[model samples]
Target: MDWEYFFELLLGGLTRGSIYALIALGYTMVYGIIELINFAHGEIYMIGAFTALIAANVLTMLGMNELAVLVLASVVAILYSAAYGFTVEKIAYKPLRQAPRLSPLISAIGMSIFLQNYVLLAQTSDFLPFPSLIPELEFMEPIAHIISSAEVIIILTTAVVMILLTLLIKYTRIGKAMRATAQDRSMAMLVGVNVNRVISTTFVIGSALAAVGGVLIASHIGMINFYIGFIAGIKAFTAAVLGGIGSIPGAVLGGMVLGWTESFATGYVSSDYEDVFAFALLVIILIFRPAGILGRSTTQKV
Candidate 1:
């Protein structure tokens, strides 16, 4: 029972959890608003990472400062990811809004596959090395040896983004519209809340958050590939389900729980079962509390 070793695993879990939380937010938000699971959301994260990689290379060729390159590349990646989110909704989803539920589900899966191949062709099927933009910090030599600047950035950035999202939803007009639409789309439309705009905006915001997560994760891990999204997406989706699919706070909680489970499982148990641990947790949650940790049971009026 080494305390230091245990704490090291805990910090690693937190960092991974932050990335999962960001990706899970996209899942929960879209589900919360439209009750549609956008399976392609994970591909948007993958694209963001690739976009950032390309942007970083271009900036480096221009001899930009390291900090400037990181900042600019992240911005470009976020914007591109947001555009993809917006386009996917408009082209694939908006048309089938009135179709059967299964239609959209299948469409989402198809889109996810298409994006994977699209990247595989445009880029390479092989894993690409992600640029290391996060500068190393030597300032925290005294506190603990396990903690690093990347972990600190991941945690702090997640906190700030979550807080900003909360404030946006609570105080902003568009956020109010989103909430209204989420509660009841027909009623929101009756009250002049633009449901279409709200949904698109939701996708944009969610995609941007995912982009940030992708960038941070690429920097943390040092490499990425087109297929990275599939596994990460599934795990994030599981976190969303574990936390209560449509609940924002639940998504965050579920991600942290999943991360901790994986961290401890790998450290004490075996890395081979890291993913098994996540899915097992999901199955247990579904069996005991289907609605999720923070999810509430609902009754239909029909």
Candidate 2:
């Protein structure tokens, strides 16, 4: 544990935190609106990364430059994931909204399994290498260090996206509709808010964010398997819980906390036990402050 090691780990943690935060937003937004956990969200993330990878490879095969291919891939991945998310909501969850709550949860889980198997079948189950859009760079300051250009891009990209999302949700007309729907669906419908449209929009936005996260992480890590989403989803869900499930800002804070916790734990303890520390912290947080750090507790009317 030297200063350089500390800074490097911190930087890595922050980048990872950003990805987790993005994915957590998808979870929190859906939960806020319907109180159902979308287990397929992780699979959606996995597909996003793969979609980007496939797009980039196809562009390269068609003789496009790497930079251009990267741009196209990112755009395609986001759009594809957003559309897929919207469809999932319309076809899978929308019809079940009025049914028993457990129905949607089961459907989500089934979708998750289906996605995992589908990907495994379509593209070999073995881990595939992700394309690197950004070159590696070294910090030439007092502490010379190596950092990927992707890391810088991931952090900045995610930060800008988060800020834009905040603005969208806080100031835009659709944002108000989203809030109204989240508050009370029946009242929102009475007030002229199209509940279906709002829900669809929410899914599209959240899924697109997750897609961006998936692309960034895939580029940074360089390899991904179909099962990657399982752990990542759990961690993102933990982040949502840690930040107060329905609060957008809380997800960001929770993601950073969870990322830093794992980073420090691995640095001080053992990498083998990194996962244990993460869940342990989650349990501790839940036990002491179930509402989360920035979350306001609410009571349900019986």
User: For model 2, how does the per-residue alpha-carbon lDDT over 1-302 read when each residue is reduced to its tens digit?
Assistant: 49978888898788788879879989988888778898889888998999999998899899988778878898999999999889988888999989999999999998889889999999989989997865555552333254467767887876787688789889999999988998889999998999999999998988888888888889889988999888899999999999889888888889999998888888888989988998899889988999987777888979
> Which lDDT tens digits does candidate 1 get at residues 24-48?
9999999989989999999999999
User: Candidate 1: lDDT of 103?
Assistant: 94
Listed per model in order, the count of residue pairs whose N, CA or C atoms clash below 3 Å is 0, 0
lDDT (Cα) of model 2: 0.87
- Score every model by TM-score: 0.97, 0.94
Candidate 2, pairs of clashing residues: none
- Where in model 2 is the C-alpha error above 4 Å? 137-146
**Looking at candidate 2, what is the lDDT of residue 7?**
85
Model 2 weakest 10-residue run by lDDT: 138-147
Cα error, candidate 2, residue 6 (Å): 1.8
* CA displacement after TM-score superposition, residue 297 of candidate 2 (Å): 1.4
C-alpha lDDT (0 to 100) for residue 58 of candidate 2: 90
What TM-score would candidate 1 get against the native? 0.97
